[model samples]
Target: MPHSNTSQSKGLALPPPTIVLVHGAFADASSWSPVIELLLERGHRVLAPPVYNRSLAADAASVRSVVEQIDGPVLLAGHSYGGAVITVAGAADNVAGLVFVSGYALEEGESLAQLQGRFPGSSLADHLVYSPYPTSDGATGTDVSVEIDAFPSVFAAGLDSTRARVLAVSQRPLSADAFGETASLAAWRTTPGWGIVSAADHTINPDVQRFGYRRAGLRSVTELDAPHLVMQTHPEEVASVITGALAEIG
Candidate 1:
């Protein structure tokens, strides 16, 4: 039998929200592989889409497009830049809640660049490498990626050095505009939210992550002793928090 949006067993009702996972810059949908396994084991429908790291608005629109195809309510989750994408895309009507795994939750009119600088922990500015790419109008646009040597140490410190090195080599770079674009809407304002704070994160300061989560009024917050790649380093922990978020809205 097909699963309905709501299920009844005994006298209680269960909410079956489709889980949509979004990855941040320097990554693709594969970043959610670990977490996907856990969510599926728990019987939740999950979708992890490729978010082209070109511009914030464009990435958000890509996420929105994926959400629109789902047949039921969604629990949208994002990491790093992915968090910023969901903040803009989560405004969709079918979105039920949001999960931020060491992700940014920018407010209206705020850019990820501005939010990262709000606190003093991130070393991203010092490690970034930029290249020029042709834009729609024939002018050049900046593409940003972290130095290969800096990736394992700065972005994935919580993971093994070998794995981090591989991730660094295969990482995707985001357009400079993605970091500078101001968010049009903050979905967390009206949607229930959950946050996973990577205590040892270097990409985005842990303090900034906490502030974003607090400012958004997240219903639940989990602090883990991990780095920016918290979802990868601590997938079970990340999944636990996501499960909690799902329970809250149900």
Candidate 2:
């Protein structure tokens, strides 16, 4: 492949690649603040694309919009449910690599519903939904408040009081349909992979994350002794992992 035109210039001519950070359900871009700062410190431009789980298809379009605005290579990553979105969002042209932070790495047509079917009575399932309601896409919606309650152990078990409080107030409603929708491609299959395993994650089982990432052929792995909010719990380590992934490609 031809080098980007700027690569031809002498010193400082190689412009930094853009690193797009996508947050998972029940939270927004703020989740990646610490991690994003670390990436910026290393001289890469970071883009945290905001998305809503209820708006699954719209999330894809929003991701596309973010990718279009950038002029260089993209290093895309997502936490939790956000992982599925980026698999579709950055799995295409120009995406250089991906990092999955305790996220569901799915294949085409696979939704959270389908995956959770393996074990339906986990804390999350028990607390979150009784039955689905109609959504804008003619699909079903869920009750997300139940998510925070059921997975509190997995997510905020060890968080600082201040951060934990913020988490409670910031958690948003994620749509039910997004979970059941499978990704067209596992971006990690094409893009080099980095997986963040939160050993104590309750919201998403740690074993599940490990299994999915291994199936994707990830060679670079980092384990955090945190809860479900892996990135939020230990952003510094997570940022270092992101930097490590860049070193592999750079």
Candidate 3:
């Protein structure tokens, strides 16, 4: 059964908002494993869905579908590129709030390329490996992934070596087109938001995270001296942020 918590403002009981976790580029829903375990233990209903990493519009639509299926309010939390996905998806009527964990918070008419370009410190560009794949229309599409040997140091710096190695090899590549697609909506403009900045991040550049979160005017901003994979290294802290967002939503 779903967890229920009382809304002090209405003086009535309501089911706690479901947390929808969206994974970013070069990663799958499994990236949320540790955080999911913690949220579940606390009785929060959590769904960590996989984003296609194909394009912003398509990915957002996919997640919005998931949110609309839920019975009650939902708190959409996304990591990395997943952040961009939720930025557009969180506009769904059922979405109550957003939590950006080492994620992007883009504005309308902006693309991930545009946002990242504004801040120039990320080393991710240098480490990316691009390859061609066949698209549905029989045309070639480009997939972007980090070099296997460089993935651990760049994307999962704080994670255990053995686990990081496994993750490196199992990464989900993002379509190159996603970088250039502009976001049709900026949900944070209307939705309440909170953010966690991985201060020592190398994958997306900590400054990029800071700039986006600041512009979004998120309700709360927490900075941790962690790496790009803050979810893996600091699951407890990430869960706390989500819990806090839920409290505010109540």
The TM-score, computed over Cα atoms with residue i paired to residue i, of candidate 3 is 0.94
Give all TM-scores, in the order shown.
Answer: 0.92, 0.84, 0.94
- Name the TM-score of candidate 1: 0.92
User: Tens digit of lDDT per residue, candidate 3, span 35-69?
Assistant: 99999999999998878888889999999988877
Q: Listing every candidate in turn, what is its Cα RMSD in Å to the true structure after a full C-alpha superposition?
A: 3.9, 3.8, 3.7
Q: Model 2: clashing residue pairs? A: 54-175, 108-183, 109-182, 110-182, 111-179, 111-180, 111-181, 112-179, 112-180, 154-202
lDDT of 3 at 147: 96
Off by over 4 Å in 1: 1-15
lDDT per residue as tens, model 1, 124-191: 77899999999989999999999999998888787878899999999999999987899999999999
- Candidate with better TM-score, 1 vs 3: 3
State the local distance difference test value for candidate 1.
0.88
Q: Model 2 segments beyond 4 Å from truth?
A: 1-14, 119-122, 129-143, 147-154
Scored against the true structure, residue 157 in model 2 reaches a CA lDDT of 68
- Candidate with top TM-score is 3
